[model samples]
Target: MSILSDDIPALILIDIQKGFEDISSWGTERNNPEAEENARILLNLWRSKDFPIFHIQHCSSEPESLLNESNHGNDFKDIVSPLVGETIVKKNVNSAFIGTNLRKLLDTENISKVVIVGLTTDHCVSTTARMAGNYGYETYVVSDATATFDKVGVDGQLFSAQLMHETALASIHEEFGLVVSTKEIAQQIN
Candidate 1:
């Protein structure tokens, strides 16, 4: 069955920034080398279709964080940068709706379904997807358009980045939202 409806869904891109490129600084192995490229393709498709697009920028409150506004890493990746008129939601937390007016904006526009794609699949993207589902929006997470890094478990065991990414998606699927591929979403929207 198609996860997407006939009604067009708004595109919400979360935290696709230069900060994610600093692998050494992040101190972890990463997966999905083509995430950015896949995100770019979706962004271009959304723009071409004149769909509502929102760019979520993470402005970390911590001074040492790479996403701090004062750092160059806070800048959006060139390929998925918000255009002059597209809405840019600045957030300090994982969920874009927490401190931002994203929910209100969507409400005003009558946007009930959202197609999400972006950085770290486990963090911001997953948080947003969960919240979106709870808020009654039919949310779809594009798996290939998001990536994450290896993490140390509570027991101090390291997990592969790919495993973490897939697990994150699996955890959200059929509960928070549907996990689809970039190609699947592209076909649905196009």
Candidate 2:
């Protein structure tokens, strides 16, 4: 059940921004209200060990978008905000690696494994997980530490937030990374 080893895994948090607080802007409703708290748990662990931690902030292109660089919503949520000396990678697209130096930073640090936790499981979180796997990193997506909102399908049927969240994790699990809980990560490190 251990997801880690002698090599320390970098903690990659994707888009845990204040913009996500606006459910209307993102979707109908979001699943896992405790996502930030759970991420905070893992973040503290990483900080305790002085492991590599990357905070990926999404900078939306739309000027009116909540995640736009000039908006206060673009700032990281207080629960899991980065401290001094932490690596902060700002990206415009879904994947943190796209149009950012995330890959280069990982390569420079010689990090072979990554533990990802953040907002919108079906979007940025999923995209980053997929890319991390493709990049040959041993990726682990924390299930309880990432979430998504309900969406209307093409047929106009409403999909539940919980359903969307679970499905996103499913797609990432095995293929992209191992979907685990915050507890699983803590157990491994402890």
Highest TM-score model number: 2
Model 2 CA deviation exceeding 4 Å by range: none
Quantify all predictions' global Cα lDDT against the true fold. Answer: 0.91, 0.93
Give a tens-digit lDDT track for model 2, residues 1-190: 4556657899999999999899998788889999999999999999999989999999999999999999999999999999988999999999999999999999999998999999889999999999999999999999999989999999999999999999999999899889999998999997
**How many clashing residue pairs appear in each of the predictions shown?**
0, 0
- Cα lDDT of candidate 1 equals 0.91
Q: How do all models score by TM-score?
A: 0.96, 0.98
lDDT of 1 by residue, 1-190 (tens): 3645566689999999999899877647899999989999999998999999999999999888899999989999998988999999999999999999999999999998898999889999999999999999999999999999988889999999999999999989999889989999889877
Query: How accurate locally is residue 49 in candidate 2, as Cα lDDT from 0 to 100?
Result: 90
